[model samples]
Target: MSYVFQFGPILDRWPLFLHGALLTIELAAISTFVGLAIAVVLAVSRSFGPRPVAWLIGAYVELIRNTPLLVQLYLVYFVLPKAGMRLDSNQAAALALSANLAAYATEIIRAGLEATPRGLVEAGLSLGLRKGRIIRHIILGPALRSVYPALGSQFVLQILGSSLVSAIAAEELTAVSNNIMMETFRNFEVFIVTGALYLAMVLAFRVFFAQTNRSLFRWAA
Candidate 1:
């Protein structure tokens, strides 16, 4: 069958698509920040908490990591509502993505934490630094520096994965494109344009993080 390209019709709805893209970026930004905070705590707990606490955190990480994010999202969105704790689609998407991202980040940051040298930790102790102070000043920097690249790549991946939120009708970029395709009957063209938009967003995030790392990690210079 010959296919007709109707990109022009889809382009007419650019404003709706733009708004959806903005929502997606907002969701990603919130989730990334919240997830990173949770990850830092989990990572530190795994490294320094009591045995039982560490084991619990490890299990949580493994469970989340092994499961599919879509299943996780469904539990948060559909199942939670059935349990009388309801969340809107966007909020549920953000919560689900944040929890999923946290599991991965926990492992990433834990690896970074483990990479700290024993000698450097001892040096901090000899300088009369408390354990917390030693972890913050002596270990945190090198650990983050060692894993910043991985973290950056994960952040980009998270941005791309945000598209899945559309399954819940979150009206993100992909959701917007789907709507446009339905309205304009331009399925292929709309999707192609949306894919380009997603690519641009990912590239923008990469560049932003690259500059942020340069500014934040001057010691790495």
Candidate 2:
């Protein structure tokens, strides 16, 4: 009852919040796009590529999954500089997030591929289709469609996970919030608004994903 709340300082900084939020969205979108591309490749390779290649892909998936993302981010941002491949904070953040997302999505997609009936693949083969063609034409779409929901969920997690990128000073929503909190010294009010913004972003994306699922995969229903 004694704590008086003041939001004027936070509200006055709307433009900063907007900038930071847009950056957050950009980070998540880039990761989702890049990550999905990588996931599809890894999943297909692991499922149908040659044994040695598949084993390498499997090892990659397990390695990424077992490691903490913070470590991955550090390696990309900090360690790579020593190797003569330096990326700025945002570039590093995007790369790390994309790599992490790719691993989990790969597993989800693999499960979907497994659930697909083998007969369909056999049918494609009987038609003289190459195994690669069979995977591309007859297998990839259905396998991905079956797991779209899971992939979408992983993307949502990636958005939240992006908050962690602030550790490298990527200037995303959380990083911006921290800056504002330091200046305003209103940690309580600043975080409450920041949390609300995150919730709104997540909900908005969920709705978009739901509508997209309906339009894009309605045939699956």
Candidate 3:
């Protein structure tokens, strides 16, 4: 049982691995941004919109939350082409991941909204604040601050989940690892390095979020 270990080949392809890692970060960034936008819309609507609209949004949340993400990716991968909305692998992955993230993010944001006391709105009204300004400055800001940790954690999950886009040949970190494994026949080493890269990225993102949380919510602190 003497299996020789060699990382020289894997190390030699540093450029490939670096490219893949950057692409993975790119995918995560795209999905998180677009998903947060969608989540904000859905959350505000769910929290304050009419009953029928809330119900529809609730249905979407349930459907996306209950299903496997791979299935959702497959649906986007196959369905759009037939509908004449052509998108490449990366675009499709970004769209699918964004939708998936939005569902969970909507719930996170709505919970923050719910935790806000009704008296805050009343207080804003008493202070001569218009409804729009109250919602923006008085309500949403605090609510978003309350939920920033959860949202940041969700983005980390998004980064990890970007690995699945390899299923559609999106050429992200995991996809590149697979290619390296094939070329070097070093599945174990390839994954170990890829996992390390992912860990480093996640830790870096957590630090960034921490600093941002301090800067953005210093008033609350």
Candidate 4:
């Protein structure tokens, strides 16, 4: 089948595409922050809490990791409404993405926490540091350092995965591209531009994370 090459029509709707891209970024940002917070709590619980708490977190991580994100998104969007818990498409998408990212982040952070040296914990105790203080200052720092790159990669993936939100008419970049393609009748050209835009967004996120790492972990530098 032959495809049309109408870059002009796609370019004409640049403003709409720009709006969608901005929304995508905003959604990703909000989800990432929420996910990271959930991750920190879950990782801490898994690593340092009672056996039951640890087991619960482990189950949550396994369940989320084993399942497909699309299924999770669909369940959040469709099934919840049937249960009388209504949420709009964008809210459902954001909640699903945040929860999914939290699972991965939990595992990554737990690994980092596990890698912390026993001697440091002993040192903190000997220095009269409380368990909470040790975990907050000594452990959290090195643990985060160990997992920084993985966390950054996960954040980037979260941004890409946000594209799937478009399926629910969240008006993100991919959804905007679909509309553009339908309007312009230039599926290939519209997708090519959309793909480039996503790549640019990912690169921008990488740069921002790198700078954040430098500032946050000055000792690592």
Instruction: Write candidate 4's Cα lDDT for 32-148 as tens digits.
Output: 889999999999999999999999999999999999899999989998889999799999999999999999999999899989999999999999999999999999878979798
Query: What does candidate 2 score on TM?
Result: 0.96
My TM-score estimates for the predictions, one after another, are 0.93, 0.96, 0.95, 0.93
Output the worst ten-in-a-row residue range by lDDT, candidate 4: 2-11
lDDT of 2 by residue, 1-221 (tens): 59999999998999998898889998999999899999999999998889999999999999999999999999999988778986899899999999999999999999998888989988988999998788888888899898988877787898899999999999699999999999999999998999999999999989888889889987778
Comparing 3 with 4 on lDDT, the higher-scoring candidate is 3
Instruction: Give per-residue lDDT, candidate 2, residue 113.
Output: 89
Question: How many pairs of residues collide in model 2?
Answer: 0
Stretches off by above 4 angstroms in model 1 are none
User: How well is each residue in 75-144 modelled by candidate 3, as lDDT tens digits?
Assistant: 9999998899999998999999999999999999999988889899999999999977888887797898
Residues 42-106 of candidate 1 have per-residue lDDT tens digits of 89988988999999999999999899898998889998888898689988999999999999999
Deviation from native of the Cα of residue 178 in model 2, angstroms: 0.8
Best by lDDT: 3
Q: What is the lDDT for 42 in model 2?
A: 92
Off by over 4 Å in 4: 1-4
For candidate 1, the 10 contiguous residues with the lowest summed lDDT are: 3-12
Ranking by lDDT: 3, 2, 4, 1
In terms of TM-score, the best-performing candidate is 2
Give model 1 RMSD, 1 decimal.
1.7
